[model samples]
Target: MPNAANESSEGTGFQPGDGVVEEASELQEASSADRTPEEEFLAQMLAASGATNLKEAGLYDPAEVAAEEERIEEEMSPEERQAKAEHDALAAAFSMIRERSNEGKLTTPGTWAAAGIVPDHLIPVDFSDLAFDEIIAAQAASAAAKKVAEEAAQAVVADADADAVSADSSVEDVAASDSKADEAADENAPSVDEGDSLDSEIETPEWKLDDIKVLEGKQTYLYSSDYMTDTYAHWAFLAEEGDDALTLVDNAREESRLYPRPMLAASLSSKPYYWNAEQIEQAWQAVQESGSYPDINTCEASNGERYFYSTDYLSDAQAKALAEWYSVERYMNV
Candidate 1:
């Protein structure tokens, strides 16, 4: 058995496993004290370098490690200091230039100064190394473009003035021709007094014409549809009751003729009439049932919606064209 009094004073009251820890701590303290500064530094370096063992300790060269650091107290000469300051200034200027260039602003020193980014002292350095030539060329090109736009605008104005003069001349010529036509018509027309005198002078006719004179006019009458006249009586009877069905068909026919376009049945439910959904559907059904009107045609779109147009007002070709135009222009948009 070990005697309590015989234990070392430094490791008094040691537990059963404390003897190994105490010995290790004492050995480490003794080793640390015996080591010189270089050895201590080398050991610290070894730890910092993450050396697992002494075999990997060649990661540092001890010869390069000086015992003492040497720093000369000689101040920088004016030229050297100025050169260092210029280098720093140039670096700062280039940094600002690159940053502004990335932001799509002009990279000139003047622009930088206006933006309050570059310092006044940093502006006078060597910026010739930057792509100033390219910037200048771009500016010159922009000026040239502006000049060309101005010239083109002037040319357009001149052409408009010439057109105005030509239009004035044409209007004057039309006025002169109209004046001559009016004079001829007035000379040929029977005045009120002359008509009265002729009635008084002749009981019947003094001369008989052998040939009839034909006046030149348009070949076709405007909006003259045989189908409209044929269908008018039926439409008139249906519209006499002021029914929405007749109104729908009447508007479809009239507007289709005037605008030369197909009319969507849905458009009838909006504005000036404001028919409800049921009313519009009822009117549309009535239009389909009325077989007396053969010129009424309906086109069904891809979405299974029907639009109505009247062939009484439009030819077959015109109605087809209008349907196609409405499919792209109105139906697709809606």
Candidate 2:
């Protein structure tokens, strides 16, 4: 009989009864006995590629393989997971450490001094950094200024009071002297003016009564005064004309004497320009029937102009009547 392994190889196609076939059979047997399938495949690839050793063939070293095995085990283990978690926590704390280190560098002058750092010392300190004596001095200055102002104000008040007292004394002296002069005049007047008696003096003619007129269809009253010494004298004429005239006269009496004369003239002239001839006739009839206008003012014969006088100026009511007439005329013409 043949050799047992050789007989087994001949049963398969590896043996064709030649020397080369016999060598192949021996190699196959050696591989089957010594190597796993994976190793055998690696070795076959390495030989075909003409590499001399495992390292040259790009095959992993024993150390690297062992490390790969440990890595796989660690990935699957809870202890490895805990160790990785601890490493991540350490990395996160690195930023806090860096910030604390920077803060320490800023606060501790000795740290910067060791590194030869120089301070600028340029920032200013406020009142909070002032010495106690300096603070007290500032407060004293403020109090002194306030006291000076108060002293000046008190001096002014004292001077004003002294002037007021002097003025009061002068006024009292003047009033006493005037009283004495009035008494002397009263005692001496009747003996010296026998020929020039008060009644024989040329009586100042009062403003003529029948000369005033209000225009037709108008509510205004007009007057003229040729020789009146003051505008205020005219109000006596209004008082005699009853309520309408008296009401206006009272208001005028209260007005200031400084009001312009032309404004007073315009206020008394309230003839509406746009009234038709019929309306004019009706208004004229009303005024003539009432007989109220002539007692209130005088009119001029030269141009049918009327005038009134008062110490106080004509009031807003009288002014508004004239303005309304002018506005109506203007609008109608437009």
Candidate 3:
């Protein structure tokens, strides 16, 4: 006689894996019945969004959403496909930037482009500490990076336009077009002449500034790096070492403390720069002669140690007292 299990299986016409499928179906039903408020809301949203599987709609299921999106995109025309992809890329890039800005982590901007949001060929542009301050020369440097992203987006449009050019298009006409493009590029390109000022090319960052405004208009948003960069780059002339020194000094000055020359010297003389005392002095002298940062100056302690400060941010007497403490008194306490 056959076993009771064999008889039951035969009576139901059950196949392998059929039990698992039925169990899954029952569990899904049970989950639907027991949905929490957020899950129920997600299910309703997925239903309204025309998702094929409302049960798969949740914060944890991006792969499913992407698969659904890819399926919908497959039905669009080539032009529609390209436009949608580009739009989504820009949306992702800007959204990530805005969110990071709120959290104050927007220091290395090239990471924004490198995070797979931008086209693959342009990922190498993410290596900058862009501050975008009109108050400093780095604003022009910042624009240089922004320009690269702009050019990449524009290149896509240019390629499409090139495809539309008539096969019989004349050489002279193309040359004339090329010449005009070159002229426009030359006119807008940022100047980087040694010892020259970039004040002309500067535009007020996407927020208010304490000093000068390069471009005249209202800014609607923040770059999250603004708060941190403002203190560091406000007096920068686009020189990296000098700007970093300013950052160290300004941070100390804020708390009525003086930044030590030994610390500043050690930081600058290390690794890639290896800037010596003479170079540091020459750089400072250049800054002084330029008079762009009249408020910035140095003080010496009784021990002959030097300290930096900005008159705009610190009082002369207060800075002198702190210079002594940083040079001598702090060591005694230690």
Report, for every candidate in turn, its global Cα lDDT versus the true structure: 0.49, 0.37, 0.48
Model 2, range 1-334, lDDT digits (tens) per residue?
A: 1122332233334212222333333434465558777657756756776764454455554554565444454544454444333333322322222343333211122222233322222111211122123324444555555565566456555554444444434777757655554554444344436425532443322212222221212122222222221232234234323334433333333432344221222333332123343543444455546665432322222233323334235344453443344434456677
> What tens-digit string does per-residue lDDT give for candidate 1 at 1-334?
1111222222334223232333323333456677777656655655676654333544333222221111111234444444444444444544554453333222344443455543334453333323233334444555555565566456555554444444434777767655655554555455788656644543332112111111122210111122223243333323334476667778778767878777877776654356677887887788778765566777765555567788888776776666666665566677
Candidate 1 clash pair list = none
The digit string of per-residue lDDT tens for model 3 on 14-80 reads: 3343323433334345567787766566556655665434334323345544554455566566655
At residue 230, give the lDDT of candidate 1.
23
TM-scores, one per candidate: 0.26, 0.15, 0.38
- Candidate RMSDs in Å, in order, are 40.1, 50.4, 21.0
Q: In lDDT terms, which candidate is top? A: 1
Clashes of each: 0, 10, 1
In model 2, the clashing pairs are 217-283, 223-298, 223-307, 224-298, 224-307, 231-309, 231-310, 231-311, 232-310, 232-311
- Ranked candidates (TM-score, high to low): 3, 1, 2
Name the regions of candidate 3 deviating beyond 4 angstroms: 1-23, 26-64, 99-116, 119-222, 225-282, 288-296, 302-305, 310-318, 330-334
Query: How far is 121's C-alpha from truth in model 1 (Å)?
Result: 99
Q: If both were scored by TM-score, which would come out higher, candidate 2 or candidate 3? A: 3
Let me know the TM-score candidate 2 reaches against the reference structure: 0.15
